[model samples]
Target: MRSIVFASGKGGVGKSTVTLNLGLTLAAAGKRVVVVDADLEMANIGILLGIDATPISLHNVLSGENEMQDAVYAGPNNMRYVPASLSPEKMERLDLDKLPSAIKKLDDSSDFVLIDCPPGLGPSAVAAIKSAKEIVIVSTPEPSALADALKVRALAERHGVKIVGVVLNMVLGDRSEIKKEDFETVMEVPIIGLLPEDVEVRRSAALQVPVIIRAPGTAFSRAMRLLASRLSGEKLAIQETKVKKGLFSSIMEFFGRIFGRK
Candidate 1:
């Protein structure tokens, strides 16, 4: 299972929005995807998805009050959603030790586990990072968000989790101060995606639907789909692949070996 955690240091960086869209995109592509609202403090992920039923909140799972399956809610398009509890006690009193097993169980069943982590590098963020196979840093192309994103990148590298890549959101596409290329160079990680600032982003969130599902034709959705493909290891004709054929010499050898038996 591919465990992808989406986190940001500052608020309103569109981290949750991206997580929602990414989940929908993966599910649309036939991947068995599940989203865990790891942001236990301000877990409003259910709100964005229009999930009014409480079902089984994360509080129950972590507290041993219920099994992980009990907390899992099937979302729109059959995507599974695990909402975070707004209860203060659950956030403060919940034991971190029990989290690993419960979360691992979820990961084992899902093809892609997308975590909507809380803002800031707090205990929740640390715990999410510790459990994930890879971390995706989301930022809004602003200095404040960018700085925090760099910190998250460092944290992922320090913790030995692969920094899958950094995602730049709310970009203007022509912004002078925010060049997408500089992000990769400075952070020492690949820039997996660059999402433009679109009003549909807010509207989709307001409607509890990911932009991809709500407006698949929009530029935002297209960019997200491209990102999904890249993350899934899909090779596009234009994108560069690591293993080059060395200008045809290796290819000739492969062909030669196949037909040389004749």
Candidate 2:
């Protein structure tokens, strides 16, 4: 199995969101994908997948209360995810040393294990990085985010972890944003993907579903699919009919109409 940790140097760069969407996209293509929410403090993959009600989480596994397999939960698009507990009490017992072993156990059954690492180069983030064989850095197209991402790249290099590439998220075509070429030159890594600043991403997050499933036709989803394809080395074709407009879309449309918006 290939273990890849999706990381960022700073928060609000949408690393977790990117990880969830890519995991789902790979799972939808029939790959055996497992996403682990390694962000102990701010664990939100369960919320994003709408599986927050799960009692067993990564905290249980890390605390030695349960096996890793016991915390695995089925997620959307045929993906399996290991969510971290939100309970403050459980977070305290988390043993970072157990993390590498927990991640190792999933290698036999998974084609790709995508770990949603915590932002910044903290202890938890370093543990997550050490557990994975490779890393994918996620950052926005801005100077501050890029600068922080450079630190992450340096961390990855220090550990001798192979960097697959960098993903540029929340890219707006405005002149103020750093160009793709400049980002590559600074990070010393090729750009793997570029996700635009799309409203659908926010709408899907508010609805607690992946944008690819909530609005498959949106630009964000298209770019996400392309990103997944590049990583998996397979063409992940768009399937809009797979996800129909649901109550969330209806409600948003109602509000849009009432507010005289598109």
What are the TM-scores, per candidate, against the unseen true structure? 0.85, 0.91
Error of 1 at 124 (Å): 1.0
Segments of candidate 2 deviating more than 4 angstroms: 237-262
Over the stretch 10-112, how does candidate 1's per-residue lDDT look in tens digits?
A: 8888888899888877777777889988887777676676555374688778777888888888875567888877556666557666665777888667989
For candidate 2, what is the TM-score?
0.91
Task: Write down the lDDT that model 1 would get.
Answer: 0.77
lDDT of 2 by residue, 30-68 (tens): 889999999999888976765434678899998889999
Per-candidate Cα lDDT values, in order, are 0.77, 0.88
Clashing pairs in 1: 48-208
